[model samples]
Target: MSTGHTSVPEVLDALKDVTYPAGKEQLISAARQAGAGDEVVKALRGMPAEQYAGRAEVARSVRVDPDSDPGTDAGRRAGQARRGGKPGLSQHLREEPRTPIQEEFDR
Candidate 1:
């Protein structure tokens, strides 16, 4: 599992033999037994002490190095630009006109 950095696939490979609904300790131990490196172990150690249902759950729960995740690369980020994000969360509220309309009854 030592490929310089820890990725989801690498983490999953290390935990392949682990039982489902395993806790943090169980994961760490299994990774170590599978010859995982410090980075992988560290990532697993940082995970919350909860039962994991399966590989998918563990993959989602584990935090991998940003550099290792291609989805967050500079190219992807540029492509996903939000045009400086939304105008604001409450932009619609400010769109209402302040001046009241003159109705026949009011007149």
Candidate 2:
């Protein structure tokens, strides 16, 4: 759920006017030093209108498949090809290592 509000313009305005208690320069400096992504720093430097506009463009550029079929024979074949074996959580772990927190929690 959301706490404060849902207006895009208002959220952008808040992001533009957001102060880090430390300061804008400090925040920007920290963002730079911490190897923050280019998009993040760009959003910080620019105004709300620009940020929102760019975000809108990005959202528009995203290609969402509207014809997905999770139950078709082709879909099942695709799923099996992607999984390559086993299934579910076991398959995920085999492909990628888990974090320490996950290992501890699983135990």
Winner by lDDT: 1
Tens digit of lDDT per residue, candidate 2, span 51-75? 2233343222221221232333555
lDDT of each: 0.69, 0.37
| Ten contiguous residues minimizing lDDT sum, candidate 2 | 58-67
How big is the positional error of residue 103 in model 2, measured in Å on the Cα after superposition?
56
**What TM-score goes with each of the models?**
0.58, 0.25
- Judged by whole-model lDDT over C-alpha atoms, candidate 2 comes out at 0.37
How do the residues 1-53 of candidate 1 rate in per-residue lDDT, one tens digit apiece? Answer: 46566777989999999989898899999999999989889878867677788
Clashing pairs in 1: none
Which parts of model 1 have CA positions greater than 4 angstroms off?
A: 1-4, 67-107
Best by TM-score: 1
